[model samples]
Target: MALYGKLETEVEIKASAEKFHEILHQKLHHISNASSDKIKSCELHEGEWGKVGSILYFTYVHDGKVSVAKDLIEAVDEENNSFTWKVLEGDILEHYKSFRIRVKSIPKDEGSVIHFTLEYEKLHEGIPDSHSLLQLCADISKDIEAYLMGNNNEGSFIAKA
Candidate 1:
C-alpha cells in the first residue's frame, strides 16, 4: 500500500490574528468574498461554530466542477489562535484520504499563518504532486485576509448581503 504524504503551505495575513480566526470560524454564510467556491457555501453540520468535533459540510467547485465534502473540526485553540479540520467524507476522497487546515497567530504582529495539508491516495502512477491544491489553499488564505481587511469590494467568493 502507498502511504500518501501531506502537503502544506503557509501565508501571513494583514489582519489581527483574532479577527482572522473569528472570521474563519464564523458561520460559512457570513463570509462575503471567499476565494474558493467550495468555501463559499460552507455551513456547520452540527454543534456550534468553531467548536472542536463539530462537522462542517459544504459544496465546493473546482475547475468548473462541483463536489461536496464533510469535514470534522479536529482541534481549536483560542490561546494560540489556531484551528484544524479533517475531511470525514468528500468527493475528493477518490484521490485524497484526508485534508486539513491550520491557522496560527504570529506574536508581536497583526498577522497570522494559514497552513493547509492534504493526504492523498495515489490513484495512478501518473498522479501529479499536490501543488495546485496548495496554491488553491494559498488563494483561499489571501481571500480571507482581504475580506477581513475590508478590501473585497468586487465580491468574488464570499457571500454578499
Candidate 2:
C-alpha cells in the first residue's frame, strides 16, 4: 500500500462560481452559520482572509464525531477560483503525517463544477485514503450551494422571482 493518497469529488452547482469562491477564500467564518451542524465555527488566527500564511481554526463535526482543526491558508488563486489549506494542528494530524484540502471552481457555459481534493501522506500504509473526508467535503459544498441559492435543501436550486 502507498503511504500517500489523494481523494477527489466533483459536483455541479447552480450557485455563482464567484460567490462560492468568495465564501471559501474570504468568508469562511460564515460557514458555521450556514451549516451549524457540520461546522461549528471557523475563525482566523493569523494573516488576512484570501491571503497566504493565514491560519484558520475550525470547529467541525465529521464521521459522527466532533473535532477541531487548525489549518494554514496555503494558496488562494482568484484567477483559477481556487483555495488550498494545509492542516497544521488538530485531530487530523493524529491520523496523517500531512493533509491538505483544495477546492476549485471550474466554470462551464451555464453552471460550474465545485471540485474538492484531499491529498495526504499517511502515518502508515494501514490507514485508508480520505474517502470519508472527501464525502464530508462534498456534502458541505452542497450545503453551501443550497445556502447561497436560498434553497435550504440538497435539491438543485430553482430560481425564484
Candidate 3:
C-alpha cells in the first residue's frame, strides 16, 4: 500500500494573478533551487502555456543521479488562477506513485497571495515525509514574489532562464 500526503504554503506577491502565473510557467527555472540541482532542464512538450493537456519535460537529478520525465498538465483554470501537473513518466516515479502541484491566487490590496500545493503518494515506508518538498515549493514561491516585487537578490535554486 502507498501513503498519500499533501502540503501547502502561501506566499504574498506584489503582482497580479496573470503576471504571477506567467512568470511561474515561463521562469520556473529561476525560482526553484531545492530541486534545481535535480532538474537539468525543462521544456514545453505540447499544448500552449497554461493550457490543459500541455506537457512539460523535465531532466532532474536524484541521489547524485540524473534522469528525465514527462509531465501532463492536468488542469488549468485562469479564471481561478490555478494550474496542476501530473508526472506521467520520470525517475521520481520509482518512489513516488504520482505527483501534482497546484497554485491558486487570492486577491489582496497592493499584493496577491499565491497558494502552492503538492500532493504525492509514497511507494514505500523509507520515503521521507513531504516536509522538505513543501519547503522547496514555498522557497520557490518566495523567490517568485521577490523577483516580481523588484527584490531580485533573493536566494534561488536556479539561474534565470
Candidate 4:
C-alpha cells in the first residue's frame, strides 16, 4: 500500500517554449551553465540523453546542502514539451518511498508558461507532508525561468504567489 501526492507549478517566462523544451530534451546536462548557483552538474549515467528510461545523475545545491540523485527519464512527450523523471536514489528517498519530477512548457503570445510537477509517496505515516519540498521546487522553477529569460541579474521575474 502506497500513499501519494502531486504538486504542480507554472511560471511565465520570456523565452521560447519550443527552444527551452528542446534544450531539456537534448542538453539537460548543460543546465549548470545557465543556473550555476543552484545546479552543480548533471550527467547521463545510463542510456542516452532524451531517451525514455535513461538515467541521469544530478548534483545540486539544495538549501545550502549538496544533494545527489540518480533519476530515470520516465516519459517524454515532444508535442506537449513535457518529460517526467523518476528518482532512483537521492536525499528525496530519505522521506519518500517514491518520487518523480515532470517539466513542460506551454506557449503564450507574450511568453511561455513553464510548468513543473512533482509526484511522490510517503515513506511512512510519521514522515509528514511535503509542503516544503514543493515550495522549494516552485522557487527553483522561478530561478530557472529568470535565468532562461536573460534576467539573470534581475529579481523581478520571481513568480508572484
Candidate 5:
C-alpha cells in the first residue's frame, strides 16, 4: 500500500459562506462553543489568530479519544474562502509523518457547500486513511452551520482572542 493518502468530504450548509469562512479562519477560538462535544477548545499559540504562519493549539475529541494538536496556518485565501493548516505536532503525527487540512466554502444559490480535504503521509502502509477525521470535519461544519443559522442552542460566541 502507498504511504500517502488523501481524503475529501463536503457538507451542504444553509449558512452564508462568508460567515462560515469567517468563523473558521478569523474566529476559530469560538469553535469550542459551537461544537462543544467534538472540539473541547481552540486557542492561539503564536502570532495572530487568522494570519498565515500563525500557530494554534486545538484540544479535541476524535474516535472516542481526547487529543491535542499544534497546527500552523499555512495559507489563507479570502477570495476563495479557503485556508490550509499543517499539523506541526499532535496525536496525528504519531500515525502520519505529515498531515495537512484545507477547507473551502463555496457559495451556492440557497446557502453554501463546505469542502474539507485531508492529505497525509503515513509512517507505514499499515496506517489507515483519515476517513474518520474527515467525517469529523463534516460534523463540525454542520454544527457550525446550525449555530450560525440560530437553529442550534450551542453558543455562537465569536472570540477576539
Candidate 6:
C-alpha cells in the first residue's frame, strides 16, 4: 500500500490579513527577497502571475541542501484568502508520487494567522514524512511578515525540522 500523509502548521503574522494575502497573490516574486534564507529565487515560468493556472519556478534551500520545484497555481480563493499549489516537477518528486500545498491567511484582531497544509503520497515506504518542508513554510511565513513590516531578517532565522 502507498503511504499518504498530511502535515500542517500555523504561523502568526504581525501584518494585516488583507495586506499579507495581497502580497501572497500579487507580489509572489518578492517572496524570495522576503525569505532569502529559505528561498533563493521565485520566478514566473509560464502564464501570468497571480492568476489561476499560472506556473512558478522556485529554487530553495531545504535541509541544508538546494532544491528546485515547478509549481502550478491550481486554485485561488480570494474570498477566503487561500491558495493551492500543485507541484509538477522538482526534487520533491523524487520521493513523492504527488505533492500539493494549500495556504490560508485568516484575519485576526492584531494581525493574521497563516495556515499551511502539505499533502503528499510517498513513492515508497522508506521515504520519511515532510516535516522539514512544513517547518520551512512556517519560517518563511514569519520572514515574509517581517519583510512586510519593514524589517528585513536576512540570514537571521534558520529553518530546521
Best by lDDT: 5
Across residues 1-161, which tens digit of lDDT does each residue of candidate 1 receive?
35466676777777666666677775455653455454557787798788888898877665557777798888888887777877788776676655565556544455666656665565555656667767766777787777766676664333332
TM-score for predicted model 1 compared with the true structure: 0.78
lDDT comparing candidate 4 with the true structure: 0.78
Report the C-alpha displacement of residue 73, candidate 6, in angstroms.
0.2
Task: Estimate every model's Cα lDDT from 0 to 1.
Answer: 0.67, 0.86, 0.69, 0.78, 0.92, 0.87
On the 0 to 100 scale, the lDDT of residue 145 in model 3 is 62
Ranked by TM-score, top first: 5, 2, 6, 4, 1, 3
Cα lDDT tens digits, model 5, 34-61, are 8899999999999998999999999999
Candidate 2 residue-wise lDDT, 20-129, digit = tens: 88887888888875677899999999998779999999999988999999999998889999989999999988889999999999887766899998999999978878
What's model 1's lDDT at 83? 75
Residue 46 error for model 3, in Å? 2.0
Candidate 6 Cα errors over 4 Å, as ranges: 153-161
- Name model 3 segments beyond 4 Å from true: 25-40, 60-69, 152-161
Ranking of all candidate structures by their lDDT, best first = 5, 6, 2, 4, 3, 1
Q: How many residue pairs clash in each candidate?
A: 7, 0, 3, 0, 0, 0
Model 5, poorest ten-residue lDDT window? 152-161
Clashing pairs in 6: none
Runs with alpha carbons beyond 4 Å of true place in candidate 2: 152-161
**Ten residues in a row with the worst lDDT in model 2?**
152-161
- Model 5 spans with C-alpha error above 4 angstroms: 154-161
